[model samples]
Target: MTRSPATPLPPPKARRRLRESAALTQPQLATRVGVTPATVRAWESGRTTPRGRKREAYAKLLKTLAEEEAARLAKQEQEREREREQEALPEPKPEPKSKSEPVALTPAQAFDALYAFSAPALVRQTFLLTGRREQARESVERAFQTAWERWPEVARDRDPVGWVRATAYEYALSPWQRFRPRHRHPEPPPADPGDRTLLNTLLRLPPRHRRTLVLYDGVGLDLPETAAETEASTPATANRLLHAREAVAGRLPALADPRVLHRRLAELASNERLRAAEPPAVRGGGERRARFRTRAAIAFTVALVGTTALTARTAPTHYEPPVSPGQAVRGVPHKVAPGSLSDEELELRQKLRDQMQDGPERLSPRLE
Candidate 1:
């Protein structure tokens, strides 16, 4: 006789995967997600499917993982939305007043507003760059306030924060320039120190190099953003930053050890004394926004140099021999002329003269 049909088994494998993915103990997960241990075990063993809360929690966890994956896409969408809003917003026209009337803002009012507006960002940038939590905050605030008095020119630009950032960065670098010429700190030869050691090494790097390194590696900027900030191209910026890192590395053996680099960073953060004892660089206001233009100018200069080098390679170098007292006849060289020169030389000279005479205006407006 034929046997009765067997019941389909529950999915134990799916339940076990849920527990593993959540990284929870079986009893703990069962309690948290509101399921009995036996039920959890049965689900994992494929003896039964979880109903109600258990199934819901499992679905919820999977949804959470999926959400993490979508986070980048969501951020990109938000950025696009912000751009659209900025584009759609009408430009604020100057107060409809007579051109003869000056728009006056009191220095005190301007200073206070600017200081308040930029202090936070400036402080954060400084702390990120130097890893000096307490001192940098004050310095950044001071730097911004000092620069705010000159905001009239800065406000005219599209991006004033960039200008301010560049100015503050320069100020940070100024300390290296002022190191006593007669008395220098002895270089700590080789063998990297702990986290505090590396942080100190980073601080010792010159301002431009430090800023370039921090902006590229610390801030996670691509070449263009870095070039925009530091006024160097991707290649130039990359080289300068890498060189700065190398300089730091050369001083200590820790550069060879990735663990030391990270450890030193952690140690510096933990060392409250080091963070607090450092002197402030700026006084109150933020760097003016026009500073980015200065960076761009620097990058532009580098580009010009590169262009010149390229031009030199392909350019024809026709050096003119100096005229001697008795060497000239019709402005052509005697060596290449008639009598002493052959018939072919004369033809070549004549052709050269004809070409010069008939050629279109070399210095015409079109060329200019």
Candidate 2:
């Protein structure tokens, strides 16, 4: 008895349940999974499977949905329990409260809270910096996770949201630094040479200069705040601010015309949309700071190793002055042209050739 072909393996237990519980019109599930309804039906009937990782992922997805529903239900139950407990307790006497309305938050408070609230600026900045919405989301989410984990500590910080924004930016830059490929050049952007040159020049500026300019002018941070974020003295920050402005001013063709130059320079800054966009506040204080320090250490180590290796490998092969063209040896020199060979050299060459061709067959031993 073969047991009726083992019931065709029961349609991949997960898929059958997923199909039944989804309440989706068969075509809807099919469209969702990017397969035909008939194919989904076959999977449910145990006639076939999606195969390999696809099958596993399909199963995993069902399990994940199930878990999420369970967790949600549990949270709801917990909330119900809290409500019941509150209802069971005795009410306390109300104290007379102050009649003054709540104070309006300042710009700083608005900035701090902005981390929690999604903004066009945050979304735009993340996309520009990471070049992927998922990655940008992940960076922001990671900051959020950190912020949540250290809520107590982050709440105590002067600028919690700014902390989150900064963290996200650092996270966006992390992959660029980690997977830096050697000898692999970046693709050239299809743009005017002058524009490209100008962009490249901006990239060449020091990080402090770049950040200062981008923050103060581009994203609309004031100089004192920019200086604080950049950790530069106010006067020093002012000098860098002036220099960055001057540098860009000098490079612009229209600088001689004040209004035109201002517009052109603004346009130039606008091209780097990410740098100019506002960012989400940073969430995690302790963990983010630790991760930053660790990443920084790793970067420093890599730089040191790379520099040392480059110096060591190139040092031994340093070139000396050439006595003759194509005549330089590892540790010796020889005449490049036959005419340049001295009588002594010619005789030595002859003896060397004789030793190679004759192989010591003729016994002309010299007494030393």
Candidate 3:
């Protein structure tokens, strides 16, 4: 018997939205469609197309889900129209503007505002990474400190929250943390048995996989954004995320759904009292650290300049020939006292004394 014709399907994005609207996970839909989760993901990503019976099943499921979604949207719109008609309230008049212009926040003030808004939640997020309450709090504080130090770069960033989150996660998951004095032992486990199991399972994954899971599942970043933040390609990030999910699901099957996993991650993080330091303290510490580094750099530069100057001053400007070593004369006579004179010397002295008066002898007495 010949197979039935393959059913046409909506685009990948529409298929994904339809599945999400139906509250069916990729794995769930895959199970229903008799395919692997990765196959469903591939189909959603448009990497490959399904054929034959599986294609028909997936298309059918998506059609039903899309029809239901359209009906739900229509019902919600109708309810909104009824509420609007029933209420029929006038829109409030615009408030009068003051003559004075609004004040702009200083860099410090803006930094503090961002810190106050983001720190508490970030501290809890880091706790999921390190599982140590103190370390988590410290990680967030240090990230903010770095942000303050590089405030210009951070403020210019399109997503300052992402910048700080990445910094905090890096610090929390640093391998050097294992060698820290405080990290000689693991932190106390959560009181809830389920929380303990979840935390343990999370920690058992490689650091990169754990971070990938937290970014995608815990923090709700999209696949592309998660990939970018983790410095991995989209395909590599998806693989990491899949493996992480499989590992997590293996330990606690209840967390198989990403939505449920997201909620549980929040709950798990919140179980620890991971309180971040005050913004003022973070700001002060950052400023102090910045000042110390600046001063040290200045001092080193000054020392280098001074040393160079001193060497230049003492160095010779022109070439000078070196002195040659001394040597002995080969044919010089020996010295003698008058009482110890030799016979030839005595005879010569007598002849010179005798010939002094003769004019011719005196004139010719050169070497005689």
Best by lDDT: 3
lDDT tens readout by residue for model 1, 200-289: 677787667778866655545556557656755456777887787677679876554544544554444434332211122232213333
lDDT of 3 by residue, 67-121 (tens): 8999999999999998889776877798988879677899989998899898988
CA error at residue 19 for candidate 3, angstroms: 33
Cα lDDT computed for each candidate against the true fold: 0.59, 0.59, 0.87
- Can you tell me which runs of candidate 3 are displaced by over 4 Å? 1-103, 306-368
Which pairs of residues have clashing backbones in candidate 2? 11-46, 147-283, 161-281, 161-282, 163-282, 164-281, 164-282, 164-283, 165-281, 165-282
Q: Residue-pair clashes per candidate, as listed?
A: 26, 10, 0
- 10 residues in a row with least lDDT, candidate 2: 3-12
The list of candidate 2 runs beyond 4 A from truth reads 1-145, 156-158, 168-179, 182-198, 253-368
lDDT for model 1, please: 0.59
Tens digits of per-residue lDDT for model 2 on 221-291? Answer: 66656665665655788899777767766775444443554454355534543322223334334457768
- Report how far residue 27 has shifted in candidate 1, in Å: 56
Candidates sorted by TM-score, best first: 3, 2, 1
